[model samples]
Target: MSDKPLHPRTRAIHHGIRRSQYGEMAEALFMTQGFAYDSAEQAEARFIKAGPDEFIYARYGNPTSRMFEDRIASLEGTEDAFATASGMAAVNGALMCFAKPGDHIVSSRALFGSCLYVLDVLARFGVEVSYVDGTDLDQWRAAIRPDTRAVFFESVSNPTLEVVDIAGVAALARAVGALVVVDNVFATPVYSRAVEQGADVVVYSTTKHIDGSGRCLGGVICGTRQFVREVAEPYLKHTGAAISPFNAWLMLNGLNTLDLRVRAQTDSALALARALQDMAGVSRVVYPGLPDHPQYDLVQRQMGAGGTMIAVDVGSKAAAFAAMDRMRVFEISNNLGDAKSIVTHPATTTHSRLTPEVREGLGITPGLLRLSVGLEHADDLIDDLRQALA
Candidate 1:
């Protein structure tokens, strides 16, 4: 059974089961801060070399969290993974673990607000950083240098839904011997082929799709065993960014239905995108699945779907606000990838803190509204959106 390979959905359901003697059906939650040893010598030996199942502290690791890590790693096509407190923590830890003073990294300019903050923090610590238009291959090629340490970007950027060329950028990074780290949140695990596209590390905010019901906040860094254990582990464990056992348990449970939820949401999102695409009130609709998308070809080549989120511009902030206020089915909130459909006005919410020039550069106009389609019925959502426009 251990030697047999399984599908991602199968792995998501039963990848890292360390059942106790009871043989419980569900994964057990090991809510513990520390573990005990039988003898003094045993404790010392365990400290020096902890066995695969043995654990010293919850901060370092726990059975429940380990299961989450292993499960996510298996799902992500990586040898190992480390769960973190939040998605930003995973991103920061992943980047900080690999980079130090004088090391350089190239990043896409279009990123979530929190992600930009991480890069700013990295700069203060003496790391050199460069930002480029994620959609433009020439910009990435010019920015990535032979001495660069890593290249980081969201495969599908937040708010704007700008799809990055994963294989294209990965090739450029590889030429410079740089590590490829992708934030694979928007392109959920169901559609993610980042690792196969030459990414060295894949990070996900398990808080999103992994915990689809908005129940828990957790993140994971997936990569080779050596990188997770030797590079990321020390930083994550020492910096105190480990995930709670309970949250890990929630994430584990969420995985059981992730494929179903994401697919349903994607279908609804596609329908909503098409419904709102040509509406009089909507000036532009940005969904990779849409025919008008500049990167539609790349989206097809990369994820094979438009994903569960859509962005629409209503021509002005007033019109966008009016449309959002009139919507009945979608909740107006900043969170994305929730079971409850969410509508976010990026210019005033998520990306509000960004400079005007930066926002303009990334095309985050005042009228831009990001819609995270949920598991709602497609027709109902489309009707609600149509009513909002009216």
Candidate 2:
């Protein structure tokens, strides 16, 4: 009952636990779609304004979902959070809540293909969108304007693993009174300083790291209470983007060991990346943790770890496929941040929708293969890749 702030690892497990009278050891799942009212008057009163513990319908909020939200908010150092059905729902809700026609938004060009599609959707609605090189301060400074409503970017971009300067971009947004919305999926909550670094809102595809075993799809938006409750909740609740109670319960359990899993994966990723660089078949190796990475200093200053992803160019599409076919330890799949190591060829799978020119611009080439390092032994993973490359 002490008021001393708990560390993130401890907070992830014990924070925001709302136990039933049974006082069950594990967090209880509330699977009901609706809560009963004491009477007609109480129902009307609840509709007017519900207290923290109260719930009306599953779409609006549930105890299980709220528990996940509170725990994530505590770890991310945000006032509140809203859970969503999927990662894309979280991304869409965060931006669509406040963006209106004619509003200006500047985003990094190097983003997941889906994120770029979302920006295109916004543009079709008359919102002006601009793309900038995320690692370049000059480009961000020029792209963000006085009238800009928001600036968005991934803290560490997908596939290519380009690290963006969150503080630098946030400072520019602050100058113009713009909101800074960051997708911090790669920089898992264990290493996230997004809120401290001036990000007004931080988002994660909890489907990735949070659900490390890949059991469910979920995401969360971390921000001030006003934004979560007022701006985002109203839009999300109405649009029916609520996550299922069962999924929320699974996500809560996922938070318990998130720190342990991410750290192990990140270490394995660093080792794998170093090994890839020495292989004769590898034409390029890109991982923020490596000293030769373009944004190596930024990764040290920002994330303090290279994270769990690695990008390797195996010389050509044919070579990349041959190596992937030969791999035994790594599985071929588009999903990252899993307990099982996953290797994805972005140019053909995740980023295939992008035009060839756009893919080239983002450095998602025919030979590029994204490796999401898992919880396996580092030496075993390296040997597997080495043999595959040979």
Pick the TM-score winner: 2
lDDT of each: 0.92, 0.94
Q: In model 2, which residue pairs have backbone atoms overlapping below 3 Å?
A: none
What is the C-alpha RMSD, rounded to one decimal, of candidate 2?
0.8
How many backbone clashes can be found in candidate 2? 0
Spell out the clash pairs found in candidate 1. Answer: none
TM-score of model 2 vs. true structure:
0.99
Q: Indicate the residue-level lDDT of 282 in model 2.
A: 90
Per-residue alpha-carbon lDDT of model 1 for 1-390, expressed as tens digits? 587778899889999989999999999999989998999998999989898999999989999999999999998899999999999999999999878899999999999999999999999999999999899999999998889999999999997888889999999999889999999999999999999999999999999999998887899999999999999999999999999999999999999999999988998888889889767788899998888989999899999999999989889999999999999999998777899999999988888889988998899998899999998889989998899998
What are the runs in model 2 whose C-alpha is more than 4 Å off? 1-3
Question: What value of lDDT does candidate 1 attain over all alpha carbons?
Answer: 0.92
Query: For candidate 1, what is the TM-score?
Result: 0.98
lDDT of 1 at 291: 84
Q: Model 1, stretches more than 4 Å misplaced?
A: 1-4
